[model samples]
Target: MQAAHELSQVQLLSVSIVALGFLYVSWTVTRNLLFSPLRRFPGPKIAALTRWWDIYHTVKCDKFKVIHELHRKHGPVVRVGPNHLSFSSPETFRQVYVKGCATFLKDRDFYANIQPGLGPKYSGLFNYTNHQQSIDERKLLQAKLSPSALRQYELRFLPILDTLVAIMKDKAELDLFAYFKFLMLDAIGDLAFNQSFHQLESGEEHQYVIDFNNAFTLIGLSLKDAYYGLQRVFKYAQTRVDAFLSEEKPKPGTLMEAYLENGKPKPPYTPWYIALSGHGFIVAGSESTSITLTYVVWLLIKHLDIQRRLRLELKNVPPDATGAHLASLPLLDAVIKETLRIYPPAPSAMPRVVPSRGAEMEGINYPPNVRFQLLHRILNFRLR
Candidate 1:
């Protein structure tokens, strides 16, 4: 009798726990579906109910396209998450990102998620949310990136560009993507460390380049892989820093030089920091520059008249022309701008949180503490 009573008690306890779980889920579903503050916005119900819907699309790499279509079907505002809404108007973008930029904060979960390790301290400036900190960090890099400095850097690129030309002459058809990537990586490696990655000469990606791509993955199997990848990148960067430090004569005009005072590192310019930033240049510059150049090449090829006109303008360039001189050309400048206007670096929504006391856009009152998100496709949503 005692044994039977104990068994009955165990079954009853399990039933109680399950019943409680089902009740909580029911309440959550009710609140999310009908009682949430953002319930007024139109979107697929599944999106407003759970973050999994958004995650699924993100993993599939079509969240932007899906959100664009959502706008087409549902009009301006879309409840993309239980707490997030995607705005499709350029007016909304300007109001939030331009005019109200200060009012909103970078969503740390999204921006900082890509960083290598756990920390309250930020190793990368790209994820910095504090405005003054951002400005101060830019000051460190400002001098090296100025126009005159850039002109000097342009001279360094000549040999690399020549090598690319030599390689292209032999091939009937070439992969511009791979070639441009190699060229840009070498160029940036030159600019950053006063050493080209020699990717253009080798005609293959360096180990550092491969590791960086692997490290920045936002998902799990990728995250586990990221550790090994980042370790290799840091090792590569440390090797360069070690070489620079070991030099009897410290090389002037190198990016690493700015961080050193009397051959010793400045605060936050420790060996580790320098190495991290050394790779960061490759991260920021190589991929985007290649993408932009590839787009420029494809578009110019597609439009022969524009290509001829651009070629005619280029032919007039004087020998030893600087980057500033190239910018002086009207059509080339316009082409660069128009290309960015079409395929921007961040093609879609960069999530930002609306400030306390709430915010308003497109005549809708967004309750405070919710994320004020924008759709990635602004060209189609541009306000006429």
Candidate 2:
């Protein structure tokens, strides 16, 4: 009986010691997190307190809208994270994007989540380390996208546009966005790969393009507000998204296949480079064109007078005139400019890292290892 009682006593003491040790560790961790170097910067306490707080809001809110509101409330320099600032000033644009002379490196922790096994090869949008390499790759591809190329390709694209108008004219009311997406996709394929998707004629989304768009948007939203500490969780989510995207099969005669066959910089391209560059083109080209078309349609709906003016301008063009000549139409140019100003596709801020030894921005000293974001659209719009 005495032995049993003594054993129970020892067990209780051991349990108490273990509990106390855990409590000590938890308290220390909490203290370190709350009182870190970033504690002095102002932001939502929850974001600073826990990465999950930022992630929740980023994933839930219309990211662009929320960031705008935050900028308004917090002023040009808002501490978005423990070591981050969102700058909404002209100085920021020049300093970060131009004058700072630093490459706009991808936020790796954030991008890694979006860029799952996109294979070991790094795409331009997600690879900061390979900036020069990607730039070189981009230059090789640029000949195909040059102004001269666009002019030469205009004949091919014009027929597609005419086909679009013919189709749209028959409908009493159409999902203009969907139709525009088709036109853009088909046009891009023809221009870039010398083939047509005929997606509009078929009346269905290209599964590969659809998958790429879905994956990109999901990855963007998922990482928009994640703090560094919660990266593992975000990466896990990204891996699943990327896997789904990579499974998509490429269409024959598509730009992807062209890259595979014709090769970039040679007849037999590096598969990884081809994959990255091809995916990069599709992702960027499709989204921007779609957004531009959507915005124009929305603007036309809002301002019928403007739309009428545009029609008058387009109608005045000679029937035999090239699309290149149509670029001279002042109203068409104005409408495009207005639409771009109103809703820039990549209105999101460009993030830059401070110098390793710290740097001065507009006479203010920002310590090293800190991040500064240049809200390009906001700053430019505000200047106007």
For TM-score, the strongest prediction is 1
**Candidate models: Cα lDDT each:** 0.80, 0.62
Best model per lDDT: 1
* Candidate 2, position 220, lDDT: 54
**Per-residue lDDT of 52-167 in model 2, one digit per residue for the tens?**
65466666756555556777777776666666677777766676667654444445565554444434444344444445655665665575566676676676778898988888
Model 1 has an lDDT value of 0.80
C-alpha root-mean-square deviation, each candidate: 2.8, 7.4
Q: Model 2 scores what on Cα lDDT?
A: 0.62
Candidate 1 per-residue lDDT over residues 1-384, each given as its tens digit: 999999999999999999999999888889999899999989989988899998899878888888878878888788999889888777888888888767788777777764554455336656667767667777988888888777777777898998999999988998999999999989888777667899878878888888877676665556558778877877888888888888889546777776788887888668877776777777778888888888988888999999999999999999778788889999999898777766665564678888889987767899987876775564444533
| Model 1 TM-score, 2 decimals | 0.89
- Between which residue pairs do clashes occur in model 1? 348-376
